[model samples]
Structures are given as structure tokens and as C-alpha cells.
Target: MNYFGLNHKRNNISRDSLLLEIYTMNLPLYDLTLIVPTFNRQSFALRNMRYWSGRDIVMHVMDGTKLGLTPLQLAQLDDNIHYHHMPELSIGERLNEAIDLIETPYVTFLSDDEFFIPSALSSCISQLKADDELVSCMGLSIQFEYKNGNVIGRRFYQSLENYSLLQTDALERMLAHMDPYVMSSMNSVVRSVVWKRSMRLLCIGDLSTFNIGELLFELAVCFQGKTKVISEIMWLRSYENKIIIDHAKTKSFFIWWRSDDKSEDRSKLLSCISSILTKTSNEREMVKSFMLLALNRYVNTYDKIIIGKDFFNDIIVKIWLLIPNNIKNILRLVLKPFIKFNTTNLILLVAKEWSHEGVKTNFIELCEIEKVIQYFYKVEK
Candidate 1:
């Protein structure tokens, strides 16, 4: 009923910004705040800021670089943005720092290079408003990158559709979220109260593996409430892992767990997890069992090989890419019933392969997809 970003009508909107208001549904301006953390990537920071400037949204950008953004750089953003320069902090520390400043009922993270469909976000906000037990809600996420000047992506989660964790017991909810171990649920729109606690442990724990902190976030939040994946397409993630590599270069999995270097942080992290788990199960052994569950799963999953790295069979995908679009569609139809491609088996894939009902036409003409693809096309790796 309301136009997004127009809740407080402007006196005189610029012609350019006026044209960029394409979001159809109204998103409650006060209900959610998107946290974006960036480090050393200037183009990424600017690219992200420019895109969101046009759309009316509340965002808190945490810059970890030693140098603060210049005046001209800050000029590009809008009043909706609250920029903070937090120097000399790890990504985890920056996030841990941002949690306390959140005043919104719902909180979610958007990376400097990622994009979100407005309607998908609105639908998720609606879901959270209706469900008391649901701690988080997001739509199916697809990871994409520019391949030969075209947008290419793949499903980010295995069988991600209609996924829900509504188990009354916190322990049950946490187990289901971890057993399959989807990439990262940290980006999903979550309640501030739950996400804050998760971030507290995540930052203090600072496993750097991303798996433990991420899975622990799942367990910690699910320890509080439920989570869901809606029908709408939510996030368009960048497939580039430069940011991942750069951040993890200093600490590999072994160093974080076995080496004496991370001893104090790791101890603090485990102790926090134990302290939190004790709230659910009073027995020391039970708390230890759950801590072991979180610890055992990620003693070393992606030290040398980042977990984001695909362990799947991609030869078929390579050959699939070599074929023409018509032939690819025909082959996909033929292969549809025979095999299912999951998060494990699929890596960076052609976006056209996963086209939905109305998507067969103008597949690249998706919501903000073209803009994002254009940004990726121009930016350096």
C-alpha cells in the first residue's frame, strides 16, 4: 500500500534518483536494518553504496580499513546510510562491533558485492511480522558472477525451497540446521535479539574457519527460535572468493584450533558456547556433548581448500557450458528427472539452467540482476 522509501515524502527528488525507485511493495522502513561490512575493497564499497543510494533503505556500513572514506565517497550515499569507520579490526570484530548499534526489530547482512530483490525482502519482513517463533526468514539465494559478459550463477543451498526449522525444541532445530551444513545462514534476515547473541559468540570465538562460527550462529539462534526459507529469490551472491582468501590468509584451520596463537580467542569462544548451552541443558556432560558437536564438525573442514570451493563433479558443467543455449535447455529437460544437482555437486553454473516459470523469457532481465551483473562486469577482481 505504501511506496518503499517514500514513507517520509521528499520535498524535491532528483530526476535520477526518482527514476531508480522501481521497488513495487512498501518495506517498513523501521523494521529492518541491513549491515554491510567491508575492508580494503574500495570499488566494492563504492559500488555497494552507489546501488543502495538510489533505493530507499536503511543501511549501516562498517569499514575496517585504516583509511576512512573520503568526503566525495561519503557524498555518494544517502541519509538512509549510517557509515562508521572502525579501523584495526578483523571482519569478525567489525561485525561484533556493529551488533550493538542495531535499533531495528529485524537485522540482516549484505556484503559489499551482493544484491537483493526488494520484493523478496518485503515478503520476508512480512513473514517475520506474522510468526513469533520464527527467528529468521530469507528466500532462496543464488551465487553469480560475470562469465563472458553474462550473469552466471547456481543454487546456493541444496533443496533450498520451502525449508523451515519450526521444531519446538531448540536442540532439535539446531541439529537439523547443521547435519546437512548449508554454506552460511548468517546472511538471512534475523531477529536482532537472536543475531546479537550469535554475533557475540561468533566474534569472540573468531574461529576464522567460518564453518564453526557460522554453524555456531545457527545453533545459538536456533537455540532461541526458528528459521525459514521462503519461495521468493532472495540474495545474488558474488562467486569471487578474493575477499575470502584475503581474510583467511593469516589463519588457516589448523592455526585456529591446534596452534597456540589462537588459544585465548578459541578458549573464550568455547567457553561462551558452553555458557550459552548450559542455559538449555544444565548437565555439564550434555553441554560438553553439544560443544563437542560444534567442535568436532569443524576441527578442519576448509583449511587449505575453502569450504566455498566445490568438491563436486563439474566436468559435466564444463561440457554443458560449451553447448548452445537451445541445446543446453533441451539437455536440461532430458536430464531433469534423471539427476538432481545439489549444493555439493554444483558450483558456479549458468544462470539460465535454473530458470523458473516466467523466467524462460528475459532471463537476464531479472530484478536488479542486470545492474549487479553490470557492476561485476566493470569491477576488477
Candidate 2:
């Protein structure tokens, strides 16, 4: 197994063994651990198990689904795999619990349907190990969906290709993170200390509403130190709409923002971030301002993807609802040209070169991960 685990710096090793160690050290092995909190998605879980079983990295698969794998089924997995069947816990709770179990110095999260490129992950780990200031590091991420028997893919967070949170001050880091909040670093390879602290507060402070939990995580990471997004492809995102929507059953962001206790959630979020920032009352106000800035910027940016959440609440929406289903389809086709900005536009067609998951393409960079993306998009079989 290629073990990229660092810290073998003893003065006793021979040159040849040390060279092999150097070769092995290029891969992220025991130094990094993946926290996969899956809920009611055993197929994805099993696919994940199959993918990671051969790797040398440690994976804590905390399955929150009612049905978990049998003992016989678990026996097939590698010893590096640790499975926890916590059917009763929520995702946040599971994350909170899982963080404590991480023995590795570095940690990162993966959605049930997502996959990380091992080489890119190694790159992230290398950056983290090299730089004490970097609390989080990741490569580019691309979203993929199946169509016409091909794995169609595109870069969703291209802005992040050059993004890095290198601000020295905590509040400055927070402010800089909000301006173009293209994606979350929660999934990025983070130092275990930051990951645990952020996740603990994320759970206890109840920052789950109004995307507050997300803000808490990003803030906590950047609050500690720097965050880097490299040029390599890091995440393979599954944009299967049915699978994506199935997981988004929580209160919609608009509904939660409009809720009566929004302020309470906000204050709780403040406390969560403050736990990491540990700033004065006036500085805490700065964090609050940052949260508002992030919320407004985030809402304005992604509200178009809300589908009907904001518009359905409007009284004029009844006029939109009155249109016949057939007529609505025709209108959508007619207005498609005018509707320049929407979620559908992001779902562009991926080409044949991109379909080769294991091989390197001119654009898409997920390589050496043979047949991994096909786990979710099984159009081949």
C-alpha cells in the first residue's frame, strides 16, 4: 500500500528503504481519514466501501440509515475501514460523534455519492503538511450527471481554482471568505483539530438553519489559519437531480430564514463561531456582520437555484400556478433563451474524453481512479 503517512524522520533508516518511504509518502495513506456520514443510501455506502477497501487510507463510514450492512457484508471490507451504524442520529450529530473517533491528523468529509481523486487528495495533504498556516486545502471540484449513456461533467466552482484564504487575522479571513463563496471548505482536507472544533460547535450551537452551520464551518476553518484551493481536480460531484433532492429534505433556506426564531438560530450560530474565534463582544459583532454579509451574498448568488422557494411565497405566484402543465412546458421552451441564469444551465453536456473516468482528459482531471465515478452513474452496465 502506498502510505503517504509522514513523520518517519528518524536518523536510523537506510537510503533504499527511505526512498521507498518517500515514494509511498507521495500518497495520502494513514495521515488522512475520511468521515462519510451516509443516510438511507446503502448503495452509495456500499459503492464507497468497494472503492476505499483497496486503498490504504482510513475511512469512518457512519451509516445513519435504518438498514445497515450485515456482519458478513462488513467482513469483506478492509481493516482500514471502520463502519458505525448509527440509525438514530442526524447528520450533524453523526458528524459530531465521528469527529471524535478520527485518529488521523487530517480529516475531510465526503457526501455519500461523491468521490475524491486520490492523487489530488495527496496534493492537499502535502500542502497541509508543508504549511503550518493551512488549516484546509483542496483541489478543483466538478459536477457530473448521467445522460445518453455518458458521465457528463463540468467545473462548477472554477472561481475556486485560484481561491485561497491567506488572511492573517481571523475576522479578515471570515470577511474574505464571503465575497465569492463559491463552495464550502467543509469537504476540503482539513486539520483534524479545526475539523473537530468546527463540527463540535456546529452540532452543539445548532447552526443548521439559514445555512448557518455552513457559515460556522467555513468561519472556524479560516479563523484558525489559511485555506487553499489548488489547481488539481479534487471532488467528483454527483448532480443526479433525484439523488440530490432526496438528500435535501430539511427545512428550505428561505423557510428557515423567514421563521420566527431566525434570530435565535443566528445567536446560536454566533456562539458556535465565537467558540473558535474567541473574540471580544465588539469582535463578536464583527463575526455577526460577516455572517450577514455571507448570507446576503450567498442568497443573492444561489437563490436562482431555489426553484420555487422564494417565488412560491409571492401572491403573484398563483398566476404562474394557473398556467396549464402543457402550456408551462411550452413557455419554458420559449423563455429558455431569456432564462440565461439557472441551475439547468450549469448542467452542460460532458464529452467522450470526460467519460473516461480513470484516464486524464484535457479538461477534467480526476485520474488513476479507475471505474470510481461509474459507481454512481452506472450507465455502462
Candidate 3:
């Protein structure tokens, strides 16, 4: 089946016939290019790329590893696969570099440790072909936590039904629920034109924040045309064995707000948002509501991770003092899920939830769960 859960036979047959015709004329099937950015993970990247090399798709590897792909490793790649070695660069810079080289009509980003379901790619390409106005498409992703080459836990992320947003207020709706829409790059495919245009707004020299740039670019693409979400699981993200608390501790929240170098760039990023909002025919009230909602969600999500507790406390105090009581109540309701009594309580809550699910404790059991996912997604080794 395709990413939209449609039977593959219909779509595959047509695509196959077209490919045969192209091959008869000695042409290339370069409708979509998969951009894989790697950093110090040659083995994982090579293994992941090998699976995709078998497919009739273009695979671009932006290798930023310390010790780059060896001659033997380069020889192993298929002809459709292209590799570019560069000195270490930030993820955003690496992505921009890869974007420059995309010759296909559509481009999708994948990390060294991720792989897409072949059927999912085919489905996305078919959808883009059918709709000229569609700028972006995405589906659910299955994430796995592994240790010592063994899967330790699994969770499903970003499950949204097959729905398209083509109205004037599409950007507002997307920003209002940015948590689900602004997902990992692995879960999305975008028209090359849309991607390039969006990047131009974010790529403002070294001031560009990586995480925020990605979110803004995704929003920009959706604002340009129609955006669709498919419910099926189309990507697998592998993570090292790290608990939520550990991950949170290591994460720097709102880098643009905390970093001296990035704090000034925040205005430029906001201006880009304002530009897109102005172009769309959304009302002022709708824009204000969505921007506030998005900001509240963003603040609540990173409250605990922001550089210093004192800074977060000051921000909360300012919010309480400046905002009217009615608005404060509304904000509280919106941020209820993220509101916490204390750090201990939040940690306990997380631990309780994690253990309540009967967390997998054995490698064999983890492998069994992986098998089920592979079977459901029709993934072949």
C-alpha cells in the first residue's frame, strides 16, 4: 500500500509502465531525490543507503563525517547514489548545501540513521504528480531506541490522516498546532521549488538557528500551496538508548532566545513569518491568535529545558504581570498538559507512564516488536 493507505497495485502498475517507457528511451527516473546527511556515522549511513540503492531513486549523501567514506565504501554505492564529502557543518548548513544540488522536482530529507518505506516514497510522488498545487506531504513515523545494535523500545509519532490544507488560513492552522505539523524532516516530502523558496527566507548567514529554521521552512512551504498528511507509517527513526529525562537535560531550548549571537536573528525570522502572513489572506485576529497560541506552546514545551531556571521564572513572571487575567486563564488552559507542579512530580509522572506500558527489557522482545513493524510496513531486509 502507499503512504495514504491506498493499494499499491493501481499506482505501481502505472508508475512501472511509465518507467519502462522511459527506460526504453534510455531516460532516467529522477522525479524524487532523497537527501541523506551524515555526521560521524559511516557504518549506519552505508547500511541505510544500501537498502535505498536497490530502489530506482536518487540518493544524495552529504558526508560531513570526520573520517569520510573510504574508496572501498564509495565503490559499494549504486550509480543512482551520489556522495559529497565536506568538512563538518551544522545540520542546517548541510541541508542547504544538499538543497543546492537537488535536480529532481521533489526532495525529502533523511538522516543517516533513518530510512523511508519505498511504498511511501512512491505514494508521495504520485500525489505530487496528481496535484500541481501541493507543496508538501508527510506521514507518520515509527521511532526505535536501540543499544548495542539491539532495539530497546519503540513508539509511533506524528500520526495524521490523509488531509490537505489549501485554504487561505492554512498557515494559521499549521502554526496553531505546530507540535504535530513541524515534525522531523524524515516525515516530510516537499516540492523542490517550495523548499528552495522557504530556505531563502531562513538562510540569512550564520545567524540562522537550525531547529527554528527547519520549522519555519516547513511552515513556509505549507503556506505557499496545499499541504497534505498521510496517516500511514512511512519512516523509521533509530535513536540511541536514552531516556526522556536524559534527552531533555542535554537539549538546549529556544537557542535563538538564549544565545547572544542568535538572539538578534530572532527578529529576522519573525519578519519572515510576518511576510508570509501578510501574503496570505488571513485576518489580523486569526494571525494574532495563531501566533500567540504557537508561542505559548513553544514556551511551555521548552520551559524546563531553557538555559537557566531564573530566566524561565522571569519570563513567567512577565507574562503574569503584562497579560490580562482573562488571557492568562486562556493561556493556562492551553498549556495545561505542559504545566507542572514541580520537577520531581513531572519526572515521576514520566517514569510512571513509561513503566506502565511495560517497557521492553530484553533485546529478543525488542526484535520481535521490530519484526511486527517491518511486517506491517512491508519492509524487506
Candidate 4:
């Protein structure tokens, strides 16, 4: 650790700073780096960068803007942030450049318009250091919208309180659920080494597709080990319909399905599925449950099929053949009803009746129940 702005290692540290140090250990021990990739949100970029100036951090803005900074403004920010102006680059290229320049052991990206919580970095870094197996940590996302002059704050995931990554064996049960875990790029903090490896995987896929980076990233990191959830709303994800892609948030799913990329994507995904299945003692049941979750999400929205039905069905059958008869019967009873429901109703059912407990506990609870009729029936219109 650099020990740049911190007190002696043995001294009692303040709670906030202790949290900061905990978050810091996972990264390389120098000052942290915040990579902001901006297209035209100059003002937002400036404001967000200013918030981190005095902290033990450096801000690098990959400006994809045509306008150059004046000598006066550049000199003023010289002490705070490094401005890399390149109006010609795409978002992906700009991000890649930022990735190359980061010298910190930890690297995280924030949008020009999105604001992070004051202690977000500290919390995530702290959690990472405390758990050696935790490859990455992400804060919860809360959406606060200003519509018709009203400000409404809608919280998505809870703040990470006691949640940390479990062993790989435990992760198998977690990933089988419908909403396994969310990978929010905005609020996630990763070890420098893991980030680099995941980035290499992302680069293999087309950057233009929505979530192409995220999808590949989640698969790579999850395969290595468990990822912890902090549950804090470190990020405020703004609503942008155009930016939301089918699989990820990109131009088209075809970008992931292009002839040259298909085999690679398919192989990577299947490998992930196979690895996940291999670790489980109840492989067939787990596979069926995974399929039920996938089909539920797909039938809820045709978009889920973008990965291709053949690919999807193949995995389902493989899982089915591997699972025990008892497990398959249980999943069918649990998921078959919502299999044909419309998206709106399906979502309502999930919110109303789905398990409030985390994935692991919920799955265990399912086994104890003689029948889940109380949780499944009587859906509100």
C-alpha cells in the first residue's frame, strides 16, 4: 500500500477511512484511478472529477469531444485530473485508452453524468481486501427520476451490508435463479489483475453491442470465483431507452452473433454453463431450474431468445438429462405456470410472489416446503 494520505498502519483508523483502506487493498497499493469516458458531457465530467481531487486518487477523462481545453482551464485542472482529449474515438476506444493508462492496482469507470456516493470506492475496496476470494464488488443502483417536476427515488438492490462472495460450490445454487446477480459497470470495483483479464475477454467481442463488455466480463469473473455485492446505491442509473440493447445495451444482438464471433461466444457461454453444471451434485435438477428461469425470462420478453433457441435448448436438455427425476419434477411445478405468461404479468408475479430472500437461502427454503402454492397462486392482475 502507498500509505500516501493514511496514518500509521498500526494506529486506530477512522471508520470511513478504515472502509476506504479495506476497499484499497484489492487494488495495487498506489493512489486509485477513476476513468471517466465522456463523449460531450463536459460539464458533468468536470463536476464529477472535481469531487475526487483531494482524495488519494487521480481522474483521467477520455474526452471524445471536438472541443479542446483552453490553456487556462487545463492549467487549473493540472493539479487534479489529466485531460485526454480525442474527439475522434468511439466510446469503446476511449475506454480502452483509459484502461491502458491506469496505474492503480484497482480501476473503476464512472460516467460523466452519473454521481457516485461519497464513500462508494472506500466501501467496495474495503470489502475486496477483507475477502481474498471476492474478485469484484458492485454497489447497488438506485434510480431517482425527475418527471413532470417530481423527484422520485426508486431503490433497486439494497446496500451491501453482510453480503460477500461465497465459495464456488455455493455460487452454483445462486446462479441458477432467474435474477442471479446484476453486474452494474458504473458501481463495480475490480482488482486490477482481474479487470485486465476480463477486459481482454471483452475485447474479443464487438464493443458496439450493448453490454457486450458486461456480459463477457460477468462470465469471465464469475468463472474465476465469487463476486460480492455491497448493496449500497453507489450509482444512480439514468433512464435511457435508446442505450438499452437486447442482451446487453448495444446496437444489436447480431453484433454478438456475427459469423466470426458466433463460435467463440457460443463456446464461452457453453463452457460457463458446463463449468457451473459440473460443480453441482444435482446437475440435472440444477440445469432444469436454470432453464425454467431462462424460459420464464424469455417468455416474459421475446428478447431473451436473442442468444438463439438452438443454443438455449441444447443446454436445457443437457441439464435435464443430468438432473435427478425428483429435482426436475420440482422445478416444473415451480416454473411451468409462468412459462407462458406475458411480460407485464410475469414481472408483477415476480415482484409479488417470488422469494424475497437471497438466492441461496431461497433455494434451501424451496426444499423444505411441502408445497409452494401459497407463494405461487393468487397473482394480482
**lDDT of each prediction vs. the true structure?**
0.65, 0.67, 0.57, 0.52
lDDT of 4 by residue, 1-381 (tens): 122232223223233443432322222224457778787667656655555554466778889888966666566554558888998877777776777787877777777755445455667787778888876777665444333322223444443434554656533523432233445433477777667655554544344444555555564565455677654435654432135346445435534444564766644554444443345647635543443344244233444444477688999899889999999779777987667321222211222222232211111111111011111122210
RMSD (CA, angstroms), candidate 1: 8.3
For model 3, the superposed segments whose C-alpha errors exceed 4 Å read 1-29, 145-153, 158-166, 179-186, 200-210, 241-265, 271-381
C-alpha RMSD (angstroms) for model 2:
10.5
The 10-residue segment with the lowest total lDDT in model 4? 361-370
lDDT of 2 at 67: 83
Number of the top-ranking candidate, with lDDT as the measure: 2
lDDT of 3 by residue, 88-170 (tens): 67656777787778888888877776656555556666777888877777655555643342333343453343355656566
Using all chains and alpha carbons, the TM-scores for the candidates as numbered come to 0.71, 0.69, 0.59, 0.55
Candidate 4: stretches off by over 4 Å: 1-31, 145-152, 157-165, 169-181, 184-186, 205-211, 239-381
Kindly indicate the candidate among 1 and 2 with the higher TM-score. 1
Of 1 and 2, the candidate ahead on lDDT is 2
lDDT of 2: 0.67
Give one digit per residue, the lDDT tens place, for model 1 in 185-271: 577888888888777767754465544566577677766788888766677777754534434633555455676777777566666
Q: In model 1, which residue pairs have backbone atoms overlapping below 3 Å?
A: none
Candidate 2 per-residue lDDT over residues 247-360, each given as its tens digit? 242347646665787778756755556645554888667766766665566555455545555666675577878989999889888988786322322221231222233322
